[model samples]
Target: MADRLRVIQWATGNIGTRALRAVIEHPRLELAGVWVSNPDKAGLDAGALCGAEPTGIRATGSVDEACAIPADCVLYMRQGTDIDEVCRLLASGKNVVTTRGDFHHPAGMDPALRQRIEEACLAGGTSIYSTGSSPGFVTEALAIPLVSLSRRLDCLTIDEFGDCSSRNSPDLLFNVMGFGQPIGDFDQRQADHVKADFAASLSQLADGLGLVIDCWQAHGEYAAARTAAPIAAGTIAAGTMAAQRITIEGLAAGTPRLRFRANWYVSRDIDHPDWDLRESGWRIRVTGDTPLDVGITFPVAPEHYAAFTPGLTAHRAVNAVAAVCAAPPGIRTTVDLPQVLAHLPAQSSAHSSENLPT
Candidate 1:
């Protein structure tokens, strides 16, 4: 802990706030600066934004200002799909860790954009890492490790089931997810856009396990609300789309070998009994000689689960800062980095021992 990594937290929204807090509380990290999108948030203390004691590190609206600060890494949590700013940060000689979906991997990225990111990394001699709960931990990080035990692997499937009723972002729920639209109006193609990202992870897994993917396919379905469901975004009519299921499959030599399934609903009582439902958690099942099944549950109150997802996303990126900084200059994934362990402060153990009875 003698040489702590200096971290600059970019953006301070739901995910950013959690990353900011983690950076502040981490035993091996130092808060150097913060970048915020809102002009009003500029000059406010970073600790205060995360609801912690003031650390005197003010958030700035200028990306230039944040990048100029002497820091070992930047935890980029801004809300958007843009990777231009992220590449710029890396080009400034700061290792980057982000939850932004676009930079999840360069495998599916546009050639020009991917080249730009590679150029930036080489120019600055810094590395960038991207991870989150779904495209990241649930499918690749969690499921891929389980595949190692398969002696005669047949297929691997990862399913994530959760209720998004409490989600606060109208843009995410209505625009991106098409939650309240009529079942007929929901475009399967739009929903299939995520296939590329999932495919990238599939490719990573295939490469790791020494398998070749012949082709890939994506499918989507929706469930209507049985009754009017009033959510934070708006009211979902009795017949409107209340839930969704998306499946991406990787076929190896005409056989579906790897699949990623996601089921998200407003509530469990929706009119889709056929679709699987879990209050909130991830399930990984591998079919082969030694079949394996693993369930990871996030045992939080229903209302709190909405917030828990973002925290997990942020922590995944924040926890990788050290490993990302130590890695060779380039875009990296969880597969390329060492096992990232959650290292608590020494005082935590000492404090626990002090409370023990003699």
Candidate 2:
């Protein structure tokens, strides 16, 4: 217990809040410091932000203050990717585990930016990793093992289905994601960013399988609501885009090999005829000599989804702290690191190691 890794929680948003509480509760990690960009959040007890018991750690808004703290790892779950801030953390001798989608595949990143990140890693002898529930887990972590069973692999596709009806964030659903907007109002720039994000992830998968991806392609499609539908986020007027699907493919020789499709919908009363949107879950289909189909569903109810979603993304990144800290200096992908061992809390009486398979 005394040898626990000192960790700094670098944000206090939804995902970051979960991570902050997790770092406080994790037996293998010590809460070294906390950082917040919002001045109002600064000077507050770390526990006050995440609803945990006060641990005497106050949040600071200063970059220099965060970097000066001697911590083994920094849990950076900020909303967007701040390259300069992240590089500073890396060069300050603290390994980073982030939920940002940018650093998943270093090879797919801008060559100059990749080199800059690597240089910071090498300078501090630290490592940085990006992970989350969808892009990190269902795509790469789950896809890797399934594809390994195929000696003659053809194509692997990941279908991620999410129901955002229960989410009450109108800004996130309508303004940011362009969900309730008219068909023609779909933002091309946002679509491009989404495409770029998924392309990067799919490319990482291809890189791991040793598949030569000649090109990466991305496509975004939408389904309009046929009638007005009331949901938690608000009403979706008829003819407005209600559902969105962004598919990213890694192709070789003009053939698709690795693919990922994100299916997010607020209402089922839509215009897509062929698409059969499943519940909130994930499906992986591997086409090969030993083809495999797998489905992972979130059993949590819609009302409880807001509370449930953060853990899916935050916990994995928190669990990977040990592996990230141990990794060599650079951007570590799922293939680069060992299988993330989720060291869960031990049971006391009814169930213990005796019940676990050796």
Candidate 3:
């Protein structure tokens, strides 16, 4: 514990690169190695993957090779399906901070995988956790503030409207719009499925609200010529964008108690005369005995990618791993962790690890 927290970053995706930068900036964290699935990425330096100078951290496709590196924690940044490897890392006695698929919640995940990690952490005395922006921090922020006021909760809604052309890949855009052919192709695959998208947030919301969810509903919509906007160029066709509207209803012992709606969109079509802004973000409206509405929108473009917000979410998720490693092991929500907000310097004391329970 005397030296910095040795960290291994696996999966060199956008979020992974963001985590790598964060680890580099963090005085307490040390980037030890990098892991990748692409064989072509082997032998490459981790830092170079982000267009930075090499950090002497070579990228390896071999899990064993990466695990051999002296690391106290592993940052998993792959997609949701990559969670199997994350579990393996956790079972290998390495504390994990992953952004990959799975590990979002304890209730719905495979009991066998959960048991393996539980047993592994118990045996290895390490920790494993998953995090991202929507499911990671925003969900926590919504629930924690609510706990201060009334106890009974009714519904929660989160809407994110951001410029996706800047941060996301083309496939992501297609998925948001549900635009691929054979509708089943995009619908059937768990990776592209909307169920996996809101799983974490809904789970976190239910736990935070102290409600049990029975079932939920998700809807996807896309418009080719919905709206129009004038960009730096001439008038550009809007509404040719993709958008999704999601609703999740929770039940308290089979009685409907809470409901949530989340909407995500790309394209200039969502651009309205009233919302004449450049950047995009989120709007969270929680309706209960006392109504509270808070919206975060960006007027101008930010220096970082829009997806970086999710990266921040992922960063906090991995950071949560360190906190849980200090205590017992189980599925934890934002409320269960420390109440410390982002942009604040991490306190060295134990107070940084304490937050509301789910």
Candidate 4:
């Protein structure tokens, strides 16, 4: 029996809760602590929160308490990032692998903020990185190998199609997303955020390949529902925004090199003439010497969509803990760390831990 990595599950929300369960079940990882924002969740056993047996460790509401717990790494899954809190954990010498979008690319980050995080990492000699399914996986991870298959490159586009019909949140679909609102134009602020968010990952990708992206660009379009359509969230009336596609691109020498397009819709029955909307999945296309188009489909049925969706993000973060911990202290991007490998529970018993690539 060798030493297993001690991991703290920070903030037990949707993705956080999923990470918490994974940390408990993972054979090579041990659950060190659980941090919860909700006061009611505190004092409860960590396992009980995730529908598992009590594991002796209890949830705590205080960030100070979470940092004080001696651990190797923290799987940070908080809804929104708190820089001060994140710095505190790093300063306490605990490495962090987060789903938050803040630390993806150091150069793309605000100069002052990147310096602050780098200082914290240097002070504590720890490492931190951000990753997840869409911006993390589809935007960067999957594209890395595809680009290797080409010499002369024209453009690479990653398309993410999400059918929100199975999502049961009315407020998220209607008010927050403006999905059921009359089609005029997509919100500018959201468009700006989208541009900035995906730009971070794309810039990191370009940097990894020794290519420089001169700038990032964004464009958005929408389609109105042709008729009233019922969804799990609720009913979307006719003449409202039923589908939206936002494309963000990275330019090199004024030429678009890297691109990501997100297609979200409540129904395929929209007013658009040639819009291709389908279930949740990703398609990555490369136009180059070796032209390639790869389609990744999430085979889960509609009823089980929510059940399996979180893993697309959570599992990667959980699996990345050891890789980030072994990485040199600083802001490590997907490009910086070694290949993150998954150590399933079955693998632990069937094979020796030494078999894992270092």
Candidate 5:
């Protein structure tokens, strides 16, 4: 173990770029290698992909080559990739910190995956942890504080309403929500018990709150422009709108009442952005016994995006770096490791930590 932990960054997208920059800035982590899917990216300088100084690490799509590097951990930001590959890497006795959807579900996730990682950790004597903004930081960091106010657990709720015009890339917009499809067709495709990212996050929330879901249901809503609204590259589906909301109950089957809601909405002017200014992000509300009720809203700021998203992510990455560098390796969530709650500064007065349970 050295003073600075070595890190291999997977993916080269927006979040990946952010994570890469973060690892560069962190005093305790070094960028060991870059993993990419494009053949052209292979053999290229990792720093070049991110417009940073050369670290001499080459970008390659070979997982084995990347894993073979003498590094302590992998800081993963790759999306739509299988957890099995990540699990294999972790099982090889390398620590993994990923933003993948499935790994954050809960402690008992896939029995095989859990067993493999545990075995590796026990054998290698290392640690692994996974986290992100929505499921990672918001669900755990934010929810843990609310726990203090409740004597008995009841339910929890989180809502993220944002304008992704500036943040989201083209591939993400169409692929995730079927954005380009006709509303009729898109609605029909998503009508059934189709699981999504929000479901996984809800599961994480339940796990964080120590609740076992008896049953869960997810819903979606869409509204096209009542009238045409201008957007990048000409009109986009004439006021295209897509939203998904899911609720998972902790109560047993046939229980009287069980309530929870996790929602994601992307629309052009859903709230009429303060055109005079810029405002975006979420309003999070949590409730439990002991009159626990508080709503938090962080308006989007152009300046904050650069630092806020990755800074919060870096905090989680740094927290996971130790585990990823140590013996036990496999996909693990924040709940699996020591809590990162203590590391964050107390929220300002507008957000109180007064009633939290000891």
Candidate 6:
């Protein structure tokens, strides 16, 4: 048919592995290379790392090695906030679509870091876009469409609830999220980061609605585990913090108008028994003249829910590759891009040689 866009799958972690699979399966994308940060994963076949059969493309630990490969886009799924590496990728002339939570808005980002990314985009004529399950899909992609139905919208609220017991990443669960820590010892820095990240998402939504936010605030609460329970991360001791609820609000004029709320529980039986419990999902409530409430239920097994979140995150980035490549060189967001849908390729028994590494 037509020439497919060449894509590099960077960092084969939870989200990266899913992005690799999506890139391989899409009809309009070619798997150019795979980049991994772990030294042990270097030189391994992309297929092996992603739980599929060997596909010839090997993972490299060095970003320079991956950047040297000819590619139209890079699906960057690395965890943690690293803006410098993102700028470097854009400077290499490869368009980027990432699941990183930090790049939602330019105003919320560090000014110098934002300037560097803009300079790189201008120099190489490439664009970079970032998204994730919560900040990207639920808040913007899903909420924006629902809000469009309103004739007179006053305020918008988005809530995400997930049971994260099945997630195996210790660093993400206990360390980053403060899952097993005492309520008193919970890390304020992580909470501040969450506030900033979600605030950026809220600001993006405000911009989409043509509303200017005058003030922003963040609130957090923790619920201790009632009893010891086994989680993929580790054993939770009784009375340790097992649930966290965070709300970030943006005010227009003098009212609390926009709200982004997240509720995470390591186990379902945590202190807030009244809290809505489901396999996993998000709810959006738009309040005004015509109040609208929408609930998206992801009815997967609890064990599979952990994988489902990252899989959706990766898919969002992968689906946006073409739009980013075609756009003018700059930082783009969901509000700026056209409707990007999943282009699933037809199933084939024989592997396509076109997807093989050069």
- Model 4, position 221: C-alpha lDDT score: 91
**What are the models' TM-scores?**
0.87, 0.91, 0.76, 0.93, 0.73, 0.86
Better of 3 and 5 by lDDT: 3
- What are the per-residue Cα lDDT tens digits for candidate 3 across 66-124? 87787778887765455456556666667876655466576676788778667767666
Error of 6 at 349 (Å): 9.2
Model 5 TM-score, all chains together: 0.73
In model 5, the clashing pairs are 95-324, 121-328, 126-326, 126-327, 126-328, 132-136, 148-355, 148-356, 148-357, 225-239
lDDT of model number 1: 0.81
- The Cα error of candidate 3 at residue 326, in Å, is 1.8
- Pitting candidate 2 against candidate 5, the one with the higher lDDT is 2
lDDT of 6 by residue, 30-122 (tens): 999998989999999988887777889999998778889999898887767567777778888999888876678876788888899999999
lDDT minimum window of 10 residues, candidate 1 = 349-358
lDDT of 3 at 26: 59
List the pairs of residues colliding in candidate 1.
none
What are the runs in model 3 whose C-alpha is more than 4 Å off?
Answer: 80-84, 165-192, 223-243, 251-262, 266-279, 299-310, 340-358
lDDT of each model, Cα atoms only? 0.81, 0.86, 0.58, 0.86, 0.57, 0.82
The whole-model C-alpha lDDT of candidate 4 against the native structure comes to 0.86
* Candidate 1 residue 347 C-alpha distance from true site, Å: 5.4
Where is the poorest 10-residue window by lDDT in model 6?
A: 349-358
Summing lDDT over every window of 10 consecutive residues in candidate 4, give the lowest-scoring window: 349-358
| Candidate 2 vs 5: which has more TM-score | 2
Best candidate according to TM-score: 4
Q: What is the lDDT of residue 38 in candidate 4?
A: 97
Candidate 3 colliding pairs: 79-101, 80-101, 224-240, 226-239, 239-269, 335-356, 338-354
lDDT of 2 by residue, 107-223 (tens): 878999999999999999999998988789888888888988989889998998988888899999999877889897445565577777677777888887889999877777889
**Candidate 1: residue 351 lDDT (0-100):** 21
